[model samples]
Target: MLTYTPAVQHAQPPASERPWLLLLLAFVWLWPGVFAHDLWAPMEPQLLTVIEQWRNGGHWALPTLFDRPYWEAAPVYVWLGAASQAVFSPWLLDAYEAVRLVNVGLMAIGFCCIGGAARQFLGRRFGRTAVLVLIGCPGLLMPAHLMSTIPLLFTGAAMCFYGLSLAKARVIMASLMLGGGWVLLALSGSLLLSLSLMLLGACLPLSPHWRYRRYYLVLPTALLWAWPQMLLWPYALYQADTAAFFSWWQQQALMPFGGFGQIQFDFSLWYYLKNLLWFAFPAWPLAIWSASRLRLADSDWGILGMAWLALLGFLLAVSPLQFQDLLVILLPPLAVFGAAKLDALRRGAAAFLNWFGIMTFGLLALFLWLGFAAMNYGWPLKLAERAVYFSPYYQTDVDYFPILVACVFTPLWLWAITRQHVRGRQAVTNWAAGITLSWSLLLTLFLPWLDAAKSQRPVVQQMQKAFDADAVRRLQAGQECVSVEAGNHTARIAWQQYGWLTLDVDNPHCRYRLVRRSPQATTPAAGWQELWAGARPREKREWLALWQRLPAKPTEPAKTLQ
Candidate 1:
C-alpha cells in the first residue's frame, strides 16, 4: 500500500473546504422549480407505468402509449429512476423528486470524481478550483439546469478519467471501470470518440514499459463495453436499424458530411473551436495562455498533456454533432495544464484573469438588465399585447442577445488580461469569488418565474382534474357513456397517465369505440346513460353548442389489448 505521507495527507482537502460552496451553487442552478421541468419528465412517467406493470408479475414487454409500444431506445434510465422511486417513496411526489434528486446527486459525484482526478495530477487546491470553473462553465451550467443527458454524460466522463488514472494499477479493476465508463457513455450517446481515445492510449509507441502496461488493459475493457451493441447488431440489422456510420468509421471515406470516412457531421468541421470560445467563457483565455506556455516546456508530462489536447482538437474537428457539451471531455487535461500554469503565475496573472472574469459577469449583468427589463419587460410586452404572440417555440431578441454578447466579449476579456503579474492574486481570488456569488444570487432571483411557466403544471392539472372528475369515475365503474374531451390535449394527458386503459374516441386507445358527443346523439345498451359533454377548456366555447347535452356512462371496463 502507498503510505499516506503528511505531505499527501495535507494535500487532500477537507470536503467542506474543497469547494463544497460550488455544490450549493450547482444545486441551486440544477434544482427543479428554477428551470422548466425537463421535457423528458413525460418519458419518465411512461417508463414508470411499464415498471409498475412488471412489478405486478407482468412480463417485460415494452410499454405502449397511444396503443403503440416505444421499443427503440434502451430502458436503463427509466428502470433506474423507477426502481429508485420505488425504494425511496411510494408516493407520486416521491417518485418525481427521486428521479430529479438522483440525477443531481450523480452530477455532484461526477464533479467530485473530476476533482479527485485533477488532484492526482495538479495538487489539491488547483483541482478543486478547476471543478469550480467547470461548475460555472456556461455550457455545462445551462444543461446542468435540466434533467436531461448532461448528468449522465458527466458521470461517464468522470468514470473514464478514473479508469484511465487507474491504468497504473492492477488490470482487473481498471478493466471494469474502463468498461463501465464506456457502457455509460453508450447509454448516453455515441462511444466512438471515447473508444478512439482509449485505443490511442493503448497503442501508443511507448508500450513495453511498466507505465504502459495499463495501456493494454484498455482494449479488452473497450471490447467488453461494446458487447451489448455487438450482440444487438444482428437484431438491429434485421430491424434495418444498424449503426452503419460507427461500423464504417475505419474506412477512411467521408460520408455525406465532411469527415475522415463514412462518419457524417451535423455541423461543419471547425465547430469545436467555435463553440469552445463561447462555452468555455472566461476560463478559455486562461486555458489558451496556459497551453502556449506548456507547449514550450518540453517536460514528459507536458508532452502527454499536449497529446491529450491534440486528440481533443482532432476529435472535435471530426465529430458529427459539435455541441458545446462535447467539449466537457477536454476539461480533465485542461485542468492539469491550468493548474500548472496558475502555479507558475505570479499574483499579477491571477489578478488579471480574475478581473477578466468579473468584467465578463458585469457585462452579462448589463445585457440581461437591458434585454429583459428594457426589451422584454417593456417593448416586447407591448408588441405581444397587439399581436398576441406567445407560443411554446417562441424566440425573442432577448433570449439570444446576451449569449451573442458573451461570445464576442469573452475573447476580448482574455486579451486584456494576457500579461503576467503575480501581485494581483488576491484580487483575482476576490474576483472569482464575486463572480460565483453574483451568478448564484442572480439565478436564484431570475429562474423561478421562468421555471414556473416552463413546468407541466397546467398539463398535469388538467389530467388530474379529468381523472378525478365524477364523469371519469363513473366511467371507471363500467357504464357506457364516454365523451372525448375536444381537441387532442385531454387525450394526451389521459394516454400519458393511464396508457392503453384510457377510452376516449379522440384517443387512439378509444379509436374503435363509437364516440357520441351528447345525450341527444345516441342511446347506449341498457344501464348506460349519456352524461353531460365537456370539451377542453380552451375549446369549450367553440364546441359549446355540441357539448350542451348530458355525458355518456362508460360500459364494463373495456378488455385491454397488449
Candidate 2:
C-alpha cells in the first residue's frame, strides 16, 4: 500500500460496474479461434496427458505424458480441463471443445479482472479503456485460444489484479479475493509470481481512512484465503514424488528459470523493444507516456502500475523462455496505464492510430485473401508453389460455405469501421476491430489448409491402421506384450487415442513397439520386425515406425525402417 501522497483523482468514479458488453464482444471475436485447428503438436499432447490422467483417476499430482510420470508442474492447470471434460464428454459437447471453451472462459474472466482493476483506480471510463488495451494488444492472439497453462495462469493474474483493486472499499472482499487469486496463480505454475504478488499486496499504499485495515485487519483475513495453497501444492509435491523424481523435475517447473531443458534469456534491449513495438502495440506507447506524466505523483494508482510494468519487464528479462509465458501477465497491468494514456491522447494522434489499424490489418487481410486464392485457384503460380513447398501434403479444395460466410462478414466490418470513424472512441475500437477482422479472415479462409498441413490426427489414424493385427488380437484374447513408446509423448498419445494401447495397462516391451523419430534415427532393439512407417508430410522431422518382435526368426534381419 504505497499511499505516499494521496489517491489519484481519476479514480473518483467507481471502477467499471458493467462488464457484459465487453465480454460479449470478446466472445464474438475469440470463439472461432478455439475451434479453428486441431490441438497442435509438440505441447498440447503433453498437456492432454495430464487431463487424461485426471479423468482416469490416476495419480492426481504425477500426471504422466505417455505412461511415464511427468513432473513438469503439479496438475493444477489440468484440473480445470479435466473437470470440464468429465462434465461434458461424448454428450453436450466434444472432448476438444469442452476444454477449449474452458480456456475461452478463463480469458473472458481475465478481461473482466483487468477491467475491474482499471476501474478501481482509473475510473469507469478507464476501465473500459483497459479492456480495449487488452483487446487490441497483439500478444494474446494464440495463448487466449489454446488449452495451455498460459490462459489459466493469465486468468489467475487478473483475479489477483481485481482483488488488489478491491482494497479501498471492501477490505474483507479484497482479502479473500487477493488470497484466493494468489493461491491459484501459484498453483498454475507461477510460484514466484504469486510470492511477489503477495508481497505487493502487503506493501500497497492505503488512504488515511483505509489505513486502519492495513496489517492487523487484513493480514489474518488474507492468510485464511491464501492458506489453501499449502493444502493444494506443497503437500502434494512430497506425496507425489520421491528423491529419485527430482532429477527430471529439476529440468522442468521446479527450476527458477522455467524452460523445457535449460534457461536461455534474450537479454538484448533491442529484442524487447522490438517486441514492445508491435506486441504491446498502442498500449506500450501509452503506458510509457502515462509513466512519464505521472512520475512525480506518489499516488497509489501510479505507483502500482509502474511496479507491475517494471515487474513484467523483469520477468521477461529473467524467464527461461521470454515473451511466451509472461505476455498474458504483462497485458492487463499495462492495460490499466494504457487506458489512462489513451484517455489523455489528442484527437489527431487517436485518428492516426485508427488509420494505422485500418491500413495494417487491411494489408494483412489482403495478403491472406491472395494466399487463399492462390491455394484454391493457383492463378498466382509462384504463391501456390510457395504454399506447396511449405506444406507438401496440402490439398487445395475451395469450400464455398466459408467463402460465403466471409463475404458477408467483410461488408459488416467495413460498415463498423466507417461508423467508428465518426464516433469519439476511435483508437482502441479501430485497433481491436481491425485485429478481429484480420483474425476472422484467417480462421475462416485458411483454416482447412492449416489443418491439412498441421493436424497429426491423420497420421495417427494411419498408424492405427498399420498396428499389427496379430498383436491386437492377442491383446483382445488376454495376451501380454503390448508395445510401448517409452517416454515418447506424441507416439503414446497417438497410439492410445487412435490405436489399442495405453501406458496404464501395459509395460514397455512386447511383440509390438512404436518409435517416433526422423528416418535417420535409431532403429528398434534386436529381434524386431519393421511393419509400417509414416511421417507428417508438412514437417519432415516427425517420423514414426512400428516394429514387431520376431524372437523365433532363424536369422535376425538388419535393423531397418519401412
Q: Where is model 2 poorest over a 10-residue stretch in terms of lDDT? A: 10-19
lDDT of each: 0.49, 0.68
- Candidate 1 segments exceeding 4 Å error: 1-74, 90-93, 169-173, 189-194, 205-211, 214-263, 296-322, 345-349, 359-448, 459-562
Best by TM-score: 2
The deviation in Å at residue 493 for candidate 1 is 5.5
lDDT of 2 by residue, 1-562 (tens): 7668876675323322445645555766777666646666555666776777667876666666544666553467677778888888759767777777777888888887888888887776777778777878777877777667777677877887887677776778777777777777767653667777766665654433224555346656877768776356655755776642354435554334643445555564455656777777767877776777675246666766666767766766665554454556777667887777665576677777778888898898788888998888885899988877766666776778778867876776676568533322456776887787777778788888777766677777676677567756766676745555455667667656555545333455566666666777556667777777876665557688877777784777888988
Q: Give the TM-scores of the predictions, in the order they appear.
A: 0.60, 0.81
lDDT of 1 by residue, 46-104 (tens): 44444455455532323333333333222344455556677776554454555555566
Report backbone clashes per prediction.
27, 7
